[model samples]
Target: MARIEKFEDLKVWQLSREICRDIWHLFEMTPLGRDFELRNQMNRSSGSIMDNISEGFERNGTREFIQFLSISKGSCGELRSQLYRALDRKHISQEQFDMIVVKTDSESKLIGSFMSYLNSANYKGSKFTKPTSTSNHADAQNPEPETQNPEL
Candidate 1:
């Protein structure tokens, strides 16, 4: 498997980013923009999905990453709930609601699958491993190696 050096390399993070962008577009183009409370909540929840994933991945531990992924998945559900409110308020079209819902559902599933994989994998993440020492102490000066898990 190719090493996942950063959260941006993960497919789930990329999908979350796309969902964030789409939510922002809805705010800009729909009546949802004028509904300050719902708009802000939607914005935060959508952004949380991506932000949590990155935050967890940067924690450098499989356990912490999984925790963050769980948060991101919850944010997906929160955003979906907000979307329903927007739909009920006539702030968004049914078509728009359907599209975003599909994306959020997919993101939630992807994060759940990732967490399951991490739970079962032999790799315990970079933070669990000790840096190898050499005569020159190069490993000590260099940053810890990136996690070896494949991006998903």
Candidate 2:
């Protein structure tokens, strides 16, 4: 498997970003914009999905990354709930709600799968790894003898 150098390379994060963009579009085009409370909550939850993923990746630890990914997954669920509320309130069409919900669900599942893989993997993380150089170890083990001074 190729190394993931950044969170942006993550498929889950990419999908979360797309979902956030879709939610923003709904705000611009739908009555949901005027409903400030729901709109703000929705915005925050959607943003959290991607933000947490990036934050976790930057932490450079497998445990911390998994924690943040779990949070991001929860945010996905929150967004889905908010979508249903928006649908009930007539703030969004059924089609819009369905589409966004599907995306959020998929994002949640992807996060879960990633967390499972991390849990099962042997590699802890980059931060936990130590540098290994045979030459450095040998130098450390045997130092050069000091020269004697004749006129002390």
Candidate 3:
């Protein structure tokens, strides 16, 4: 099994967390937190983006891991949507909206690229998976064969 020793090494995940931290601080300035509904929804969705990536990396199963990463991408989208809602309701300034939107979009693309990278490699995450699987053409209509458990 391959180990993901540093979360920072996962650039996409790290950036997502940074974006969330900035938003969390911004939220503190507003009475939005008192709203309960929007506040917790926004917070939890942003958090899920970071948490899912870490959980995916730790799982060390490329297929399932990529599934989780894809989920993270969706969560990033969800967070961005909520930010727009917050802005429309006057919870955030234009500058904050722009900052958060740009970063979130960047994170979204990075997640897509990461997914493409994995797809090109056939969902093989590490040296361990490489010997038994090749992800290169898996994204094509005719998918590559699934990786068997290397243990046997």
Candidate 4:
């Protein structure tokens, strides 16, 4: 596996971003954009998929990252549900609905696989790594005081 220094480097995040962009364009070009409430809600939910991934990766811990990935996956499902509404309301064509739904499904799978990999991997996360130190700061800055003799 390649080292992911940033969320953008992750395939799942990249794909999620693409899906979000597509949804944005669809809303802008289609009559769906006219529905203020649904348009805004769809935009927010689609954006959240990648946003959660980015947030989790920046958290610097495997556990937190996993939690964020789970949220992102849930967003994918939510977005799919909204797509159904769009289809039913004639905001989008059946073809468009199918394409976006497939993309969202793929994103959810990718995130799930990544989470599984993280769980079984030996490397916890960057935050869990202990920092190397040649000397103890407390010991170097302050010396221990001498104790009084009990016999005295």
Candidate 5:
């Protein structure tokens, strides 16, 4: 598999971002927006899913990343519960509830699969890898190569 250099490249993170936007837009069109408590909670939970994924990726450790992914998965469950509450309160239609639930459920599965991969993978993280070349040290000491022009 190709290297994932950034969180944006992650499929799970991308999906989470899409879900967050969907929730934000859905809430904006409904009276649930007036319910400050539920609105804020729902927004936070959705955002947390994306945030945790990005934060975990940036941690530079497979173990840490897995832990963060676990947290993100929990946030997915929280969002699902909030969807039920929204449906119960008639703040959202049955269709919207089903749609959101499906998205969250899919995200949770993705996160779980990723965690499983991390657990079995031998590549720990970049932070744990040692530099393979001394070229960096030599360049830092000399600051210039003899083959290059002295003046720019």
Candidate 6:
């Protein structure tokens, strides 16, 4: 709500960071963590949640930030799914699964709340205005216009 200066200022991101740490700790204890395929997938999904939130905040306007928040939320879901896999595979106890699930759900609710705040404050059409220049390069293709080619 207040002008966020650092990524830590965001409660959702802080929660995500904590979740990542818990996931890493779980990875160290679970047998699935020893398997390269499962380990890599779980770690990546866990890290993505925090990474996306920070990336979104660094993207400058509220619109870009909200989009990034959505991505972060998706990553959280992915992380949760992987956690479930670990549980179903008998790599973790039900207690462990429940603990992580609670954290993931809390993080999701926080992200949603942040998105709502941003939407109410910046979704009035005044916030999506693009810089009145060629700053669209990120989405634009090559500068040279393509000519027709009929010969195959």
Per-residue lDDT tens digits for candidate 6, residues 52-149, read 88887666567887898898888888888988888888988999999989989888877887787777762322234443447676433322212121
By TM-score, the better pick of 2 and 6 is 2
Model 3, position 147, has a per-residue lDDT of: 27
Residue-wise C-alpha lDDT for candidate 2, range 13-75, written one tens digit per residue: 889999999999999999999999999999999999999999988887879989999999999
> By TM-score, how accurate is candidate 1?
0.89
C-alpha lDDT (0 to 100) for residue 51 of candidate 4: 95
lDDT of 4 by residue, 31-141 (tens): 999999999999999999999999998887779989999999999999999999999999999999999999999998888988887787665566665655547755333
Instruction: Tell me the tens digit of each residue's lDDT in model 5 across 51-83.
Output: 999999888788999999999999999999998
Worst 10 residues of 1 by lDDT: 139-148
What are the models' TM-scores?
A: 0.89, 0.86, 0.77, 0.85, 0.86, 0.77
lDDT minimum window of 10 residues, candidate 5:
143-152
lDDT of 2 at 15: 93
Off by over 4 Å in 1: 134-151
Which candidate model has the greater lDDT, 1 or 2?
1
Candidate topping lDDT: 1
Give the best candidate by TM-score.
1
Report the number of backbone clashes for model 4.
0
Model 3 lDDT per residue over 56-96, tens place = 87666667678988999999899999988888988888898
* lDDT, candidate 6, at 61: 65
Error of 5 at 8 (Å): 0.2
**Colliding residue pairs in candidate 4:** none
- Decide which is better by lDDT, 3 or 5: 5
